[model samples]
Target: MSHFSIIIPSIRARLFDCRSSLFATFVLLSGLFAAGCSGSHDDEVGGTPPATVLQFRLQTLRPEIREIRESITGTGTIGAAQTSNIGVVTPGIVERVFVRVGDRVKKGQPLFQTRKNDYEISEQLARAELTAAEARAEQARLDYERAIDLLGKEFISQAQLDTAANSLKAAKAEAGVAEARLAQAAQRLADTTVRAPYDGVVTGRNADEGTYKSAQTFGADSSVLQLQEIKIVVAVVRVPEIYITRLSIGTPGDIFIGGMDGLFQAEIYAINDKVDMRSRTVEVRFGLANDDYRIKPGLFVQADIHPPERTAMLLEQDAILDRSGDPYVFLLEDGIAQARPVVLREYDPRKVEILSGLGEHESILVGPDLIRLTDGDLIPSIHDADR
Candidate 1:
């Protein structure tokens, strides 16, 4: 019934007749049986066809072309729009401190008052001198007028008229000098009261009652008081020079302060042209309105600058997949799934834009079924009938 069964008996029959009969017959029969069995098995298994092709059922959508808005972020510090150091314009001893740190002040509001006893005395003396000078000048004026009339009448000599004219001129000069001195003394007396230059909040106070201040103590490094305008604040951010060209004044932005519940609206108010040599960055400032006084100076903040909207090819967020750390997606090509690597330009929570490796009318697979699909696999799209 089998080739091996028939061959073994025939080899036994010829074993004695052959030269080296046992060895030759055994070898010939072994080779013939091995060849016959392999042929039969190959036809049994290899002739069967491949299993059924796998099909993945999925929902699909076409690539969308739409406008997308993007944002560039930078870290910065919140600072006042304007700051001033309130100092004594005249050297004096502090008499009273009307305001302290955290006090809100208006323009021309008195912040502190210096001792005015000495200045008042000087002012009174100057006024008294002015009064005396004016009396002398008035007398000289009357005498000169009378002398002129007398000379016209030939009643006074020319020498007498000349002397009267000289006296009047001298007296007027002295009166003018006295008047200037009085004005100077009054201004110095007024300077004893230091007022705010603008509406702001006092951030610091270096002097108190009975403290003496001099001109040498007033400087950027030293100040009697520090005041800053907090109604409107600025966020100073350093942006790399590479992105400077894309920014412009008045470009809208948002400032997010640390630990704040909501962000403040802002706009680009200043952009420095000079690049920092060490950091290669340019300083950019965003102005934010803080009418409620929620924002304060020296707070850390982040600025999100919205440049401009751009047109790009977009797809639903579910269609994207990661393969070996690179992003790609399964596209339905001719009813079959084709895996392609795409250049992702930008993305939000809902959608992503593909810069390349896709085209118009190309559909991508969506839903949780994406992980099951493979290259060249048939994807019988469930949404196809709806189309």
Candidate 2:
């Protein structure tokens, strides 16, 4: 029985060893065949890899920058309008000047007076001529009456009577001329004093107590009082010719003087028809009331001309999402969002310009306060977020 047991055990061991070897040979051949099938044969298309999917957003945009025109600033001086230079109209030695520079004078106010010496002499001469002419005229009248009576009675020849009548008529005419001369001399003497032609401030005085002058005082070319009306001043402002379309007569504006901080409102009283060739600007007149006269003449001023009307793009304040102090937004494209930077041209409390960011028709992500977002991040945009 022991021998039979040993034989059975040897038989079992040999059969198990034979099965293990066959399994090992089968696994080795299978591995070799699989490697041979997968190996690269250097074919032209052998290196091709599988297609990949990259998640990204596609945003359409047409951005722009603000068009500015700061290059058009201009500088000019304010001045008084054109006026006549006042001068004395009658001739005499300057006796006394009533007004000096910095004095305000009204229309027809006395300014200066000429010496009465020349006027007195003229009056005396006229009076003497009048007396002589009157005496001669009286004598001629009596002589003519006697001649006429003699002729009527046929006691005098026609030629003698005619000559006597002619002499008398000439004497009367001379007397009339003397009377006119006397009146003119008197009027001249009275008008030797100069007066203001209109209400204005005295800008200059060229006369003294002893200065001799003629009726064409200081000649027609010379000036006596350089006066100007300053009740309302006209600021001569030079606006760039490029703004020609916006500028017109009667446009309202505000002027700021360099030395003062007060605002002076005015209207465009006048505008130049021609542009300055060298300065590339057009001179416009702005009329402002100088009631208190705080804004004096020759003050350098800067003025802002408001545009009557304008049209511009606007967006709601919340629509602009600021990132790192710069206003921006995450624009949606193909179910994803792309962060975009925008420039701010102008914005009030209500709206702002998307100067360089979102396009007209692009979809922008409104909210999700805690959403971590980046360029090409998947986003869900609902038209009505507040709903």
Candidate 3:
């Protein structure tokens, strides 16, 4: 009842009666047998099943719009904006010291005093001379008045009147000279007490009770007290020539103090136009408010100079993957995941700015749980019901 049964008789008739055609008939019968066996095997096996498609239930989010900020980083030292090395104004021995190192003082507060003996004696002598000159002037004025009265009555000659007038003028001139000498002496006495020029902390002290200090003898290197105003500090950083164009006066930045936990806000207040040939860098000064005096001078600091902000596409950091050293993201398209390359402009721990190769509305798979995904793999979003 199979095709094999019908074909067997025909094959045998050809093999005996047609000797010339026997080879041809054998060839046909062999091919027929092979085809029949193949058909029978396939019928027993039945129909084939479809290939499997890999699937994952993953989460996704749309790219976000945000402002991308770029920053230039450098390291430098913190210092007082206002610094000075105080010196005595008058020549004398140090008599007293009111402040020591690390003492806070106000402007005009006396830091030290010099010997007052010579200056005080000079002042007293000048005052005495002024008094004597004043008395002589008064006597000369009385004599001139008496002579003028007598001249009006012709009791004194014109020569006598002229002489009295000359004496009064000379006495007045002497009194004026004495007054100037007294002023000079008084100033010298006051100069013995060297006061602070501004509110600041004393960083150094060179004079004690017996230290000899003189204003005229002091040279450029001489200093009695090193005072620095620390209420507002300056962070001086050297930025390379490349970043000079991006910075300007009033540009804001963040200063991270060495060995400190938090960052302090600072603003660019000055920029050096001359560049150092060896380092090829320009110096920039930033002012930081430190009213509490928590930030001290000579402390190391790291500065982050922020440039102007620009708009860009931002995405969650988890959505990005590094494949073969290139950044990529998997976007769900038509029930399948498609791998896409993107250019990253900036990044932080939570998010990244995509400079190019991504759209604002496109959804991307998020989280490391989907890292094993391959291109063209099926991803059925858990939120498909809402879609």
Ranking by TM-score: 1, 3, 2
lDDT of 2 by residue, 1-387 (tens): 788987999999999999999999999999998877667444335876744434332222232234332222334555655445666667656778888888878899988877777777998899899999999999999998999999999999999888998999999999999999999889877777777777777766665577767655454256555777776777888987867877777777778777888777777888889999998899988877765656567889777776565444455555566533876777667766677777765455766766455566666565443245667666443453322
Q: What's the TM-score of each model vs. the native? A: 0.63, 0.54, 0.62
| C-alpha lDDT score of every prediction, in listed order | 0.84, 0.70, 0.85
Residue-by-residue lDDT tens digits, candidate 1, 35-97: 899988997978876556666557888888887677778887989989988788778888888
Clashing pairs in 3: none
Estimate, for each residue in 302-365, the C-alpha lDDT of model 3 and write its tens digit.
8999989867688877778883378999987887789999988446778887878998877788
Whole-model lDDT for model 2 versus the true structure? 0.70
Cα-lDDT of candidate 3: 0.85
Clash list (residue pairs), candidate 2: none
Each candidate: RMSD: 10.4, 11.7, 12.4
Show the lowest summed lDDT stretch of 10 residues, model 3: 378-387
Q: Counting only residues 3 or more apart in sequence or on different chains, how many pairs clash (N, Cα, C under 3 Å) in candidate 3? A: 0
Question: Residue 90, candidate 3: how far off, in angstroms?
Answer: 0.9
Off by over 4 Å in 2: 1-78, 81-85, 90-93, 134-146, 157-161, 212-224, 258-261, 291-295, 310-387
